[model samples]
Target: MILNDFLPVNKADLLKLEWDYLDFILVSGDAYVDHPSFGPVVIARVLLDAGYRVGIIAQPDWNDPNSIDILGEPRLGFLVSAGNMDSMVNHYYVSRRHRETDNYSEGGAMGKRPDRATLVYTNLIRKKYKDKPIILGGIEASLRRFAHYDYWDDSVRRSILFDSAADLLIYGMGENQVVEIAEYLNNGIEVQYIQHIPGTCYLTKSLENLDQYIEIPSFESVKNDKIQYAQAFKVQYDEQDPIRGKTIVQRHSETYLVQNPPTMPLERARLDWVFKLGYMRNYHPMYEAGGGIPAIKEVKMGIISERGCFGNCSFCALAFHQGRIITSRSHESIIEEAKMIQMDVDYKGYINDVGGPTANFRHPACKKQLKVGTCKHRQCLHPEPCEHLDTDHSDYVELLKKLRHLEGIKKVFIRSGIRYDYLMHDQEDAFFYDLCQYHVSGQLKVAPEHIDETVLDYMGKPSGKLYGQFVKKFDQINKELQKEQYIIPYLMSSHPGSTIHSAIKLAEYLRDINYTPEQVQDFYPTPGTMSTCMYYTEIDPRTMKPVFVPKSNKEKAMQRALLQYKNPRNYDLVYEALILAGRQDLIGFHVKALIKPRTNVPKAGGSKKSKSSKRKTPSSKTSINSIEKTKKRR
Candidate 1:
């Protein structure tokens, strides 16, 4: 493959192809990494396979209108996306501080794309092509399609379609929606009139004759009344399925934002086909000097074995974007991708990852999901596993064995979450044995966000007892295999239901395990999550009961400090937190004490894990059920 093989990024390449006009120009926030893992590249490839001429404008100078003119105007339209991640999340930390680097940009540099990139890129396009159709897709637009709270702004905002002035917004995976859109636009249908497509949101003046849609609440009501906001989010959250979902309407001022039900996910064979599209599978060569795109390092060798997630954690946005249904590529498709990895000049004899949202989930949670759809208000493995839930991982085990046996493949690692709760539910141990024996590198990472029952209930994770059971089994398996491996449970601090007491309990558990977390993720209330609804409304939409949200920055800081109480710098805040919670008993010199007393008061000596302690994980019945965001995978 040569430079021309990749889609044209500039007019010179278009000239080299001897093309005078283009069909669609994809403008994205992320630096172009032409691989299936990137949404923009996948959409562009899908369109190209459908025989449309496509060009990409990646990380163009947003301030310069002429910068986007490099590709000129396309005959069909322009596709605008915030790339794989939400732009604001890409640019800032949860604390609202500017991030030092942009993983998606070349050299991990910040400012490659502006904040709220889809809106900015659309505006840039409008400056020159006033009448051209501009369509929005990707995580940013998908999650922000309806009127919702904005974390960085700390206020409710209108739908992105209303604010960005784009012609239409594709809310979910756009392979099906974009092709339908391309066909309509190619047939000379106006963008404003292309309102009937599933998974597309549009602005309307009247609801006349639109009797099949559900009107949750007006933007003004949701913005002014917190209760209304929670109720609206609940409706939006409930109707995400393609089978049972209805058209959703939320009015903003005089106009209405109408989101059609999500498009059905691609069948397994078609999903397999989409991955085999001719992709360069690397960042553009022009970025080589700047160390290529840092984001690609984790994904370049990994294969997206599946899409969609049934393990819907409350804080995760997958249920909103990918929906609750699960879909996967065939073993043949994945094995083919691994062969490509073997051919790469950068191959290091290891497959970085072979997983998706939940690696072990290769199909729908149950056979009923294939026919009717996912139940709106229920989860598969949280609270308790449903009787209908499928726990077989034999197919996954077979797939992994085939991958390990491939030529030039030294080891195949399962990096994308393993869903240990789901694994524990299985009666057979083939997958569990294989996961420990073949997949694990040095350490296996799992997310048990918090151990407090109250917090775990709010988080929709399995019981703490379940996590303890998983840890025991993991240790036993490693022992049986005679390998030294560790389980690093991803921990969270200051979530909606967590209190100072809860934080202390989590800290005590860490102390018992003799583990010091190198990094902790504070709760970030981004849009499209039930947790964010609780954060803003202080009420659980499901039961409409009062939820205790740790909103004050001071309390949030103290909770975070409690998670890392062993650090010398956190002594002050941890001391204050302990006193406020009336738990100063934990500050003494006993081995069970969390921190040392101040002023050289014969301070509590740091304790080591006894041999028996090393044999087990923290004993909080549900302490290590981490609800990891898996932010890097998408």
Candidate 2:
């Protein structure tokens, strides 16, 4: 409510706060939202708590070099981040089309920031203050800190530090590294010499005496050879732990890129302190008259109870950015944050979410993970749950119980992704029962991704039969509780190994259930995901086997259309997809059919005849069971 509640955004703010120069100036690609959900704000607050002056420059004009001159040069250096979401991912879609509206900007406007925002902002800062240390962090720099694939360029590019010529690149949750770097810089250590820190990457002219570091294929080799690129990705993926991980180096042209091992995750108390460090918990007032940031509406009432995830789905970037080891906050911390929500004007007695990357995972998958790090060759939840895998949800259930009974809170929800396979793996059903009773807001969304065995294998997802079992259990619980809640399964269309036949199979599953997903996810080959590596190499890095990548836009469209077969608008594409897959058997009037015959197509909106979609419907549970039974019989 006051001008000083948020960090200083411009010269006027610095003047109002009576500051002459900032100790650290953070350049971001998002609207200035002083909330804990935004990474830039967290880093800034951490720096401020360390007794340093910090200011922010959000969405600066690329054309006007003076736009960054408002905050003036910092005494320590300038910090660069591409906002919470990657800028390129924010600006364009999987189809490479520009998104019409920006959720992180004022008025939901697009083009307020440029593509590859970290590089742009770093270059802008360098233009004003040459030789000043430029530190790169956030998802953009974190994922692309090494030689990796760029979907927009369709080629492997050098590290952001290499391309931007920045001094340091801090990856992962950067609270630990940011404060360390600040103290070192405060003591007058050169940024170039600050290379030994973990969870960071830097460039060097020599790799001598660094025998502890593992050397991977160089930029030239990976860019030209797909196999080598896959190998490099595997090394990076396996060696991301702070405990067991070693330093990794890759050569680019003449210089070498060194990525120090990941920083140790914050303990419960540190995570609690980070979240409780006086966040405004809202977007800046400058945007209130301009419709405000749409992204804040989703997380303003939400609480991040944990960090990291062991559900290492290959398509997800969490493993690369947040690692697989789980770190969580304590009950008191989360409950206090929940009370903070009551102070919001928009609080309606509902807590939007209370989980992080994966909702139910509160601790490491096993006892050994915290000490020795994750196994290099095996995953906790892939192929099969590890023998030491722990599936206890008592902590999370208790947290929600305390929150549900809070004075002003009416309902507490877990909107974050729930690993159904992990949840069902539990021996007891207490958390499942609690989840259904307290968390179900008419529907629970889970990501089974795809049902086809081969695609699921490539995606590192559990077998569809497991999802079916989970679904059955979900239905039984909701029914027993007398709640009319439905399971909204998040389905994906084209992934690395998903062929038209595979897509047709998923469409058939949807047909069998008589349910259609409201939205479809196409596999996006972002910079730092194993699936993206597979997408580029056409080979699964884990097995070194060939994968069928659906790259054609038309084929992807057809696959997407198959998911919405009931819509008359998708008839043509769905018809073509089924025909191409030699699935004419699924194009007829049978109850198992995915689409109507070509002759039965309506002229516009939808169907008109009694033979249309308004026909008799079957029980969704029975239909899903039938699907599993058919798969088993086949």
Question: Each model's RMSD to truth, in Å?
Answer: 7.1, 6.1
Poorest 10 consecutive residues by lDDT, candidate 2:
617-626
lDDT of 2 at 1: 16
lDDT of 2 at 333: 91
lDDT digits (tens) for residues 376-487 of candidate 2: 8998998888889999999998899999999999999989989998998899999999999999898899999999998899889999999999999999998999988999
Q: Name the lDDT of candidate 2.
A: 0.88
Give lDDT per model, in order: 0.88, 0.88
Off by over 4 Å in 1: 1-4, 600-634
Residue 231 shift from truth in candidate 2, angstroms = 0.9
**How far is 42's C-alpha from truth in model 2 (Å)?**
0.3
Q: In candidate 2, which residue pairs get closer than 3 Å at backbone N, Cα or C atoms, i.e. clash?
A: none
